[model samples]
Target: MFFTDSRLHFFRPLVGKYREVVVECVRLLYQKLYTDLTGYGQSHGRDFVIDVFVEAIARAPLLDEEVGAPEGRFKDARALAGFILNNLLDNGWMERRLDEATLQSHYGFTRMGRGFAQPFVESGKLEYRSRNRNTRNTRNSLQAFAEKGEVYDLLDALEYSERIISDFADTIAELEERRLQLVREVESRQLIEQAADQFFDFIDTVFKPDLEVRLSADSVEKYRDQIASLIRQVRRRRKYGEGEHAELLWQTVMEMRLRKLLPGRVVEGQSLLENIVHTIEERLQSACDIMLPALRRALNSFTARADIIIRQLSYLHRQADEPLLDACSRLREMSPDNQEQALQRMGQVLAGVRSGWPASEQFVLRSRNRRRTVRATLANAPGLDRDAQKAQFISQVLDQAFHVSSQHIRAYVSDKLITQGRVYSKHLAVQDARQLLALAHVVSLAGERLDNGFEILIHPARSDSAGLQVFEASNCGDGYFDSRENFELELVDRQRAS
Candidate 1:
């Protein structure tokens, strides 16, 4: 707690005056509490500050193993804490407050304490964590807005979608601009080599990490789905003219016009919702400008330069080649005959560039004008006439259902039955209520009615002790057993004459 009384004074020092102490204090706190739980001094060893130092060093063995324990540094843990606390407290980096309920002094970080500790934390020696944006939730919200065909919902979806596309373009543009800055900063080849470390660090630590998250396949797929769904929903509602809030928006706009405040008024005869859709579509379509061939060429050139430098570094670490080996052999045998051989070997080593192997040239060509084959043409084609088709199809279905011999002569029914209702001398048997209904459709289509005395039967299928029922029976020979299905249907009704 701070007081405005004249006796109360807040002493804040420049970070440079006590930066090292601040860093040490924070490191000790993390090492003792979080990283190195064993670093705390025991009650008996509290006065032995050397043991505390030893414990602290032991906890962070990898980074602080070289730090030796200091002897005769402090009286006890209480005294040591007081000394460190006073320095931190004096600098306004920490605060000590008396709790009203507990009546005990509580030590906690002040604004300065958190501000000073950030650098140590960001050093990445203590901990590391990566957080990605919750793009899925954001996209889902936008999709919901699009699906709900209200004026405000459509407006919200439009704004959200536009932001996503614009943000993508902005990030890529920023990276392109940063890459250009290297030219002004780098003067010579040595400078370029020096800048390479910083450049690659920025790419790896900042640029690439961010871009990877933003362009993750899952996020991209969800984003595309959301955008496509929004587009479809918007167009669908517009076509149907069935949004709930359109009337409300129209009234609001009219009110604005009455007041001479022409908000969202367009010259074209389009509602505010329709204009918003058009604007969103145009922005999204143009968002791909960053990925166009022209910009891609520039990006490729930058990558090519970086690759050349990387390859050059690899070449420096490479082993001696055959030409160098030959040169060494000639030099070792210093004879007159070896002089010409040494010259030839030296020439081979100096002629660094070589033609690529001829066998490596392989590629497949795809014509730009190649047409896509229509594989679904069969589904789209018109089929045989509906009337004759329905009769033939129903007859075949009945044959499969009954499994009866053709000697009954019911199988000889013609397609003419589908076109004209006729009084037949014979009856058609249907196995179940479902089949009876199916057969009724065809009979109804023929505009024929059943005779006054018609028989229709339905019964449960035969079931064993296991409760397993046989729903179908097949005819093996001239004789087929009586069907024992859920329902046996004898077609009793037909279409009446029109």
Candidate 2:
């Protein structure tokens, strides 16, 4: 009783600073003196502070070795409380060395026994939490007290504290922006350029073609100049500072390279670049002063829009030769007239621009002619080549996924229903239909409902079939298809259909 009385008397003086803090601490200490005893110090938000003494006891060996002390002896809540309680009652704890950090952190058992003591939250005390923006909970409450002629210390504190904190936040944000600029100059640009160069190199390695080399020296230089210039401009923007909107646009260009739109293969590289550059040139030329509605959103500003278009072109450049070559293969599927029309349309987009500038008056004449070349190339040739290309694409992803080859195994999947560890149908040497179905099944079982990236699954053979059962699946969650993420073999199916 004397101990409780002394503690309460000690708390009374603290009310001068705050009544709530005094009430909360006293309530908690009282609970520790009574029920819900645990050895863990101040744990579950209940128990006496005496638990801290369990450490020294745990270290001393017992005289009688028969006591089978459990592992992590001080870890027990009951032992913790027992040790602390014993120390407070048997030892002179009041004279022990102490510090502020220890005192501020110590907890006595309060009503809530969940590792946190419940300090009394008074009726008009300041609540520092973000349940909702405390817009109405502000010194707005002080308006009533203002009319009552009450002391305004709380209101003044809240008002000044808010301004000081908010200003500090803004100042920190400005510093962060400066830091990003410095990072761009010294670090971020190098990473972006390295990424871009990697993408282009990959394209050159896999898809380099004889036809691109066959182009006249003048043609080669012209295309080279355009590509090099674009790359340089992008690197500069990343290295130096550009407007946020412009930098973001440049970032999109970088993303295309990362995405393999500016692929790492040589065979498809050149033709893809030409196709993209020519298409954009044709669209923009056609629009003239008329806002070229189609290309306007794409090429509006030089920094952001143009950089994005260039990045996309770079992607196509990386994959050019294969698509064009495959385009030739699918020409047989088209009518003789349509085939001729496609080549002629392509010739035009590739025409007019001898050097840096495109040709005069007739260049973009109208909407039909503006996008005509792109439309013709894609509608006729790509439709056909896409068939075989889809197959090759599948081969690439599968090679990357399973670390295997589709070179000799054209018809890869069997029509087997996959068991738990299932093999699939696309593995057959048959046509693209089997490949397409097989690829779809392979991309599906990746348990992709949560993650938003491509997943590769290998389904084991169904039932008792002997052939190798390998299927590739990519889960397209939320019912969205990724055009670029497509496997090359599916392009074969598309060509056959068109």
Candidate 3:
């Protein structure tokens, strides 16, 4: 009961906060429900609705027309407008109020309707005609970090991203200094503990966030290059027209004017451009100069050092065991005979004898189920014999070479030269191709004359008649055969026997 009471009291404030959030969310959902009553189906014009809501006046003349006689089944414009207002009121999207002074009725958005529409107005989504305003806002923020002066003045935006890089370098430098201090001198336990906490905080807040944005020395160098390039563009403002990049540079110039840094537009000061360029390069150099190799070493060893310190601290609290002390005393007092008897027993247990069981012809189970295995050849049944496939492949290669009398060995050996049946290309992979060539080479060495009227000959792959022409296979990914090596295949003309 006490635990339940404590838990209930602790969560009372959180429950109250959650209830308020739920009410706000429900109000938002009702406002953005996109009812047919808004007289705006999915195809309704967003701009017209926004203008009507913001300016409190309808753009279309038909919407402002007063009630008149019904034409066919159609009601008058004023009557139709009243029907829509009544629908919105019923849906909790709008409310009708009576003015005490004038004693007149007026309509406006309810709490739900105002809250829901506030986000679109504030985010500039309503101002932009396109529905992809969210994506555009995100892109603009990213571009502000990249190209010159997108979010702020040209000089100031460069300084902002540069400062993130500088802060990252400074954090690494501080970590290095602490590491050196701990290494060189015996620091107090309290100091070491504080340093450890700071190390964890650095990784969480500064280190991780910087890495997320890639605010490193290498990134700083890239930013420096971009800044320098922008400065050059500003210096040569006369040559370039208002192209895409030139327009962006002009925007930065405009931002500078707004900040009162530039006078009378047209950024023509070459000296000022050079000064800005120099300052960016100086900041980049300072960031890159910081060498924090100890950061990695410290991270790896920090845990191990803490573990060692914990063990040392715990040593003071470790209690001695009386039973273990008694066992040591007993071991010291043991006689030689008793020690020999104990050693004999231990040796007998460790050097265990091999126990042999009688060999049985069969094993009989108490109850066994009569298994009915429905044996059938599956789709993954064993493939056709590989030797027949290899021999057929070799035959096909030789058949293609039969047309050319005394064919050059290298001609038939290559995957490119084998045209008939396309054994190398269509049917077989590289390993199979190599096997086919090698088999053909062996058949040729036997000096066999086939029915195709050509005698197979194998020779060393050399320029001379005595040496054979070597055919090396392409590199096989499966590594089934030796890729490097050669043997020539030549189709020699057979002599006519009378």
Per-residue accuracy of model 2 over 183-272 as CA lDDT, tens digit each: 353344335444445434433542133112212321222343343344233334342134554545443443344335435532434443
Q: Sort every candidate by lDDT, greatest first.
A: 1, 3, 2
Task: Predict model 3's lDDT versus the native.
Answer: 0.45
**TM-score of structure candidate 2:** 0.17
Q: Is candidate 1 or candidate 2 better by lDDT?
A: 1
Sort the predicted structures by TM-score, highest score first: 1, 3, 2
What's the C-alpha lDDT at position 264 in model 1?
Answer: 38
* Candidate 2: residue 338 lDDT (0-100): 96
lDDT of each: 0.49, 0.37, 0.45
lDDT per residue for candidate 1 within 438-492, as digits (tens), equals: 4333322222223553222233334566453433345311123243323222333
Among all candidates shown, the one with the greatest lDDT: 1
Encode model 3's per-residue lDDT on 282-401: one tens digit a residue: 554554454223334544564455454455445423423354455446667889888677657756776876776756756565788799989796678676699988999999988875
lDDT of 1 at 226: 67
Pairs that collide in candidate 1 are 431-488, 431-489, 448-494, 448-495
